[model samples]
Target: MPTIIFVQQDGSEQRVHADVGQSVMQVAVNNQVPGILGDCGGSCSCATCHGYVEKDWAAHMPAAESYENDMLTCAMDVTDASRLTCQIIVTPELDGLVVRLPALQT
Candidate 1:
């Protein structure tokens, strides 16, 4: 399992363990972390799971697909590092992955 660090709106952090192949959103939701609303489950159709990849962690993620890019338009505070957590598959290399949640999801 990999450990994912989720930084919430008020700067609180939740270090949760996750299995490889699980989506980041799934880890957050399963652990009862706030901010990630995975409204469309793990599908890429919703932007409710929006989160930001810290600058140093950005290189660990692949470029967002066109469909994901389209959904992010519905998110708040979308940045160059913005990613929909549901699309972020966990892996060993992401053991210490950091995902910062916005104040709210759209």
Candidate 2:
């Protein structure tokens, strides 16, 4: 299991252990972490799972896919670190990942 740290826009942090091979959004939804709706159920169609990868860890993750990049365009208050949580798969190498949720997600 890898621990993923979720930082809310207000600066609160919730750390959860995510099972390998699951999406970061899955771990958040399953644990009921606030601010991540994941409305499309991990599909790239919705930007509800929008979040920002922490600056320090941003380079460690894989690059965002084209579809995910397009979807992120609709995210609220998007930033350079903006990413769809559903597109972030948890793996052993991704331990200690930090993602910041947006203020509001549809």
Candidate 3:
């Protein structure tokens, strides 16, 4: 399992153990992490699972697919590091990945 860290807008952090092959949003939802609301159930249709990947760990993640990028356009507070957590699948190489929740989700 890979351990992912989710930092809330208030600076609170929740560390979760994600099973390999599960989506980051799934891990957050499963663990009851407060900031992520995966309204679309990992689908790219909703941007509710939006989050920002930590800069250092960003290099290790795969680029967002076209559909995911399209969905992100609907998210609030978008940034270069912004990503939809449902599109990020957990892998062994991604252990200790860190992501930060935006102040609000659209």
- The parts of candidate 1 lying over 4 Å away from their true place are none
lDDT by residue for model 3 over 1-106, one digit each (tens)?
Answer: 7899999988988988989999999999999988789988987788999999999988898998888899999999899999999999999999999999999887
- lDDT for every model? 0.92, 0.91, 0.92
Clashes within 3 Å, all models in order: 0, 0, 0
TM-score for each of the candidates: 0.97, 0.95, 0.96
Candidate 3: misplaced stretches above 4 Å?
Answer: none
lDDT for model 1 comes to 0.92
Better of 2 and 3 by TM-score: 3
- Superposition error at 68 for model 2 (Å): 0.5
Instruction: Summarize candidate 1's per-residue lDDT along 1-106 as a digit string, tens digits.
Output: 8999999878899999999999999999999999998999988888999999988988887989999999999998999989999999998999999999998887
TM accuracy, model 3: 0.96
In order of lDDT, best first, we have 1, 3, 2
For model 2, state the Cα shift of residue 83 in Å. 0.3
Judging by lDDT against the true structure, name the best candidate.
1
Greater lDDT among 1 and 3 belongs to 1
